[model samples]
Target: MAQESSSVLARPFSALTLQQAWRKTNENPEITKADVALERSPRQEADIFVGNLIDERHGGPITIGYGRYARGQSLTEAMAVDDVMIVLEERLSVSTEAGTVSAGPGEIVYMPKGETVTIRSHEEGAFTAYVTYPPERPAHL
Candidate 1:
């Protein structure tokens, strides 16, 4: 009594709803705060994260968007709002041709527009935060 991928309504991976994943991940004794912090990027558009230990190193002459994701289709295709995030004190970092910088506690850096950037972290702790962009207001305020 099982269903095939084609018959399924949604993707298996995508099936993990935010609430479900949070609960399951938290319950999984094998999973730890450190594990979450080290988890790879989800690569979901509209993703947002806060907190984590980020660090980056300089690379050959290449403009790098310290906190930006690679280009993709629509904003949804690329992380925009609440996707691909780093937990606070999670050892996150970004390396650019110009220089390297790391986010500090209570510090946030928006991904630069049109730039190659890499983000990573390696820390241990219960990473917790959320991300959401503001709605359109007005220009030239």
Candidate 2:
């Protein structure tokens, strides 16, 4: 779901409430610290991940959702698509080959596709809303 896929509701365009999106994906378990860090299979959560939002597969495609990382949880990944994460609560840090960026509630951070990055939460951990792009699913997702 987050890694990528053909965009849904993009061609005709539609409006959906976050509540609706949650309803669509809720039957599935929310991604936890281990699912993302060790498993490298966030897309597995997509069994119930129903539909992409407003964009094309390669033309700025993105999927949206939220997840939580326990305090001290961390992971390094080779990104499969562009990731836009908004810290909903607490703080999160993303470190890449270039440098590192950190943010707290209301702040947003971006991690590009095809790069290796390390993600960690602050002592309080983090909860985030994310938009991931490219519409093409990846095994590592």
Candidate 3:
């Protein structure tokens, strides 16, 4: 009988096995309660956390900070900006020249430049997408 090889066989890179390939998809961003930090703004109380910030310039001044805010009071009161999109949860109201109305989850509220609006907490709090589109381009621009 031929002597059998006692050593372990070497497997190719393509022969590697995956433990599991499937996973449940979560829609909302993974924000732990412990990770939340409460902040006080003139508008309302905000639980702020840095999500993602994007620099829109080549070492210039245009930058976007993707942050999370949980406002329990009138947080964004009449603070004018360019635009915003609600990512996860619903909000109570968004003020505009036309009128204020209820915004649902995943709603995109586009407030143009100089559009005055106030946000009051109808429920306990709100999860929103904070956008920083300044009125005038920065001097570096």
Candidate 4:
């Protein structure tokens, strides 16, 4: 996985098991409200916990991962990258100055680049799989 991630190698190892992927993230549930308070990144604090189960940020054009947000947590910030989030559990809401939208399990939400928006979890919290473009940020950022 490390080799493929760093060099963009096409080693499509499809034999990976679900358990391995879960273990990669230590099967973590959430990042806890206490931890969220301790964190300072406005862009992702409300995202709770994120896992790079199949990290593609080393050199790939896009990266994949999963994230969990505890109930009532929210993040409002200008997006630094484009994101496509697929809801895996519960519900999610993305709000912009223009309006707001909500999606439930099995639904998808997309937030474009440079847009300032608020993302939050609903009553039951949220779990999602996501893809982000331009895997690595420019150094000046």
Please report the candidate that would top TM-score against the real structure.
Answer: 4
Best candidate (score: lDDT): 4
> What does candidate 4's lDDT look like per residue over 1-141, in tens digits?
112121111122222452354345454544222222222222344537665433353455675666778899898867678877776677877877666777775565677887787778888888776667766243111
Off by over 4 Å in 2: 1-61, 136-141
C-alpha positional error of residue 105 in candidate 3 after TM-score superposition, expressed in Å: 1.3
Please write out the lDDT profile of model 1 over residues 20-133, one tens digit for every residue: 655665577754334433222335342232222221222212211112222221122222332223223333344444444444333343443333444444343223333223
For model 3 the TM-score comes to 0.48
- The stretch of ten residues in a row with the least summed lDDT in candidate 4 is 1-10
Q: Between prediction 2 and prediction 4, which has the larger TM-score? A: 4
* Residue 93, model 2, lDDT: 71
Candidate 4 stretches with Cα past 4 Å from truth are 1-47, 56-58, 136-141
Ranking of all predicted structures according to lDDT, beginning with the best and ending with the worst? 4, 2, 3, 1
Preferred candidate (TM-score higher): 1 or 3 = 3
Clash pairs for candidate 3:
44-75, 78-117
- Number of the candidate with higher TM-score, 3 or 4: 4
Off by over 4 Å in 3: 1-52, 55-72, 76-80, 135-141
Q: Candidate 2 on 1-141: residue-level lDDT in tens?
A: 121112111111122443344445554455332224332235333111122332343355456545567787777768778877666567777776666666776566777787777777778877766677764364223
Each model's lDDT comes to 0.31, 0.54, 0.40, 0.58
- The total of clashing pairs for model 1 equals 25
Over 38-68, each residue of candidate 3 has an lDDT whose tens digit, in order, gives 2343223455343323334435233333334
